[model samples]
Target: MLTAERKRKLLEVLQSEGKILASELSRRFGVSEDTVRRDLRELDRAGFLQRVHGGALPRTPTSVEHKARQKESTDAKKRIGAAAAQLLRQGQLVALDAGTTPLAVLDRLAPDLSLTIVTHSLPAATVLAEHPRIEVVVIGGRLFKSARAGVGVATVDAYRLLRPDLCILGAAGLHPEAGVTTFDSEEAEVKRAMIAHAARVAVVVASEKLGTVAPHLITPAGRLTHLITDSAAADDLLAPYREMGVEVVAV
Candidate 1:
């Protein structure tokens, strides 16, 4: 088969199975492993798929631009944000991770309650600024344009000194085994720092992220204190996370 033909078939398989293995593809295509690897590389560079160790997983919705991400699961994210917001208390410091869902949590924050929100998300910081009783602390770092968030050393260092009562994080993928993951390594570093500095960590996920695995692991699922997701998420999928002693809140 032509290289293009093989690539087309590979994409079809990836779309149908939601993942692909290099060795399996090589055998199926009657091509050398190196040739299959080259095909994977080309597809990855073209934004067709996310290449991982031994296999490739589907590129997640979070891999898209911030605006595009916001358009997906709009109502479900609002419910998740509302549910996660209930965990906030007056005078407690909170870390809001970068994502539309985390920002949604701001809409539910009580206007009369006093709180401090520290975040690397530019949009979240902007929204929090409108609340008179809320103090917003924006982390400094190089901007990750697609995520509309900051990453790199400056962002990580800021979180190092913070001891937030809770960290409401967003994930590109949330799986029973793979845990919380994101596509960017720098974003993963900042997320790890937030997880470390917070007394409790809650991951806010939309339905699309559940059961998926991204390239960069943020932290293990067992490390989380709470998992807030939309009601549309299946109980079967959440069972494994609950088994780890993490509170599962479906809104």
Candidate 2:
């Protein structure tokens, strides 16, 4: 078949499967593995797909800025947040990570429920200030402009001082193999520290982030006590996490 024809069919297969392996594509297209690799490279360069090890996944936006993220999935975030809030207990100390979804959790908290909250998110802390019954601890450090959160040596150091009962974590990617990942190194460090300081960790994510990946690695799915996401997430994508002992809650 012609190269153009092969590439077009490759994209159709990728769209149907969400991801494609090079060897499989080569077999299906009656081409060499080298030709399949070149096709994937070209597709990735054109911003049509994301090349991964041995495969390619559909291209997804990696916007870190708050305003850009705010435009993506508000209702899903609300459902995920409200579902996460139901896990909270009065008087338990909770640590919240910095992300639009984690901020959603703070927005859904019961007005009268009392709990001590620690966070690096400016918006989350600001909202929590109105809840007089809940003591707010803001970690001070260099601001990560993209996500509008604090992340630095100071933030990690502060986290070492207290152990939170639960941590509402965020992720740039949540893959079973790649584990939990974020886009920035410092932000990953802060999240790692939060996980270390918390007795239980709950990763709250929107449906679109499922099966996605990012640059920096946090802990694996096995370390999580709970996985909170919207109902739109595919069961096939979440199955690995459930098998790994994570309590998967789809709201």
Candidate 3:
């Protein structure tokens, strides 16, 4: 088959099977392993797939732009956010990560909850600024436009110093083995710092991210204190996290 045809088929197989082995692809396409590897490399650079050690995984939702991601899983994110917000109480110091999921959590916060929120997320800070009972601290840094959040040495340093009662952290993928992944390295650094100092780390992500792995890791799934997802997640899908001692809260 032609290169374009082979790449398209590869993506199709990867999406259907959730991963691709280079050896298997070479045999199936009647192409040399070198040719199959070259095609995979091209697809990876095009953001069509993520090449792993001996195979490829689907390109994660984080590969898309921030605005685009906001539209992809609206309802699931809302449920997750509401569940995460319910975990909060008065007099808590919380760090809100950048993303629509965090915004959903902000939406569900009670007007009288009375809390201080520290964040590097521009959007999360904007919503918190209008809350009557909440104190908002915006972490300053160079804007990471893709995530529409602050990222840089300053962002990482600030999170390292503050020990928040909880962190409503961001994540691109939450896999059992690959751990908590993000697409961007800088975003990963920021998330790593947040996870390091927080008393509890909670992630509000859709069920789609449950078993997927992204390019950069923030922390292992075992390090997480809580995993809040939509009810659509299957029992098997959540089992790994639960086995790791993560409190699984499916809303």
The local distance difference test score of each candidate is 0.88, 0.86, 0.86
Clashes of each: 0, 0, 0
Candidate number with the higher TM-score (1 or 2): 2
Candidate 3 lDDT over 35-113, as tens digits, reads 9889989999998877777877776665447898888789988888889998898999998898878889988888898
By TM-score, the best candidate is: 2
Alpha carbon lDDT at 152, candidate 2 = 94
Q: Tens digit of lDDT per residue, candidate 1, span 11-87?
A: 89987876788898889888888898888889888877777777677766564578988888999988998999999
Clashing residue pairs for model 3: none
Give candidate 1 misplaced runs (Cα > 4 Å). 1-49, 54-56
Against the true structure, what is every candidate's RMSD? 3.0, 2.3, 2.6
Cα lDDT, model 1, residue 133: 92
CA lDDT for candidate 2:
0.86
How much is 90 displaced in model 2, in angstroms?
Answer: 2.1
TM-score of 3: 0.86
Would you list the rank order by TM-score, best first? 2, 3, 1
TM-score of 1: 0.82
Select the stronger candidate by TM-score from 1 and 3.
3
What's each prediction's TM-score?
0.82, 0.88, 0.86
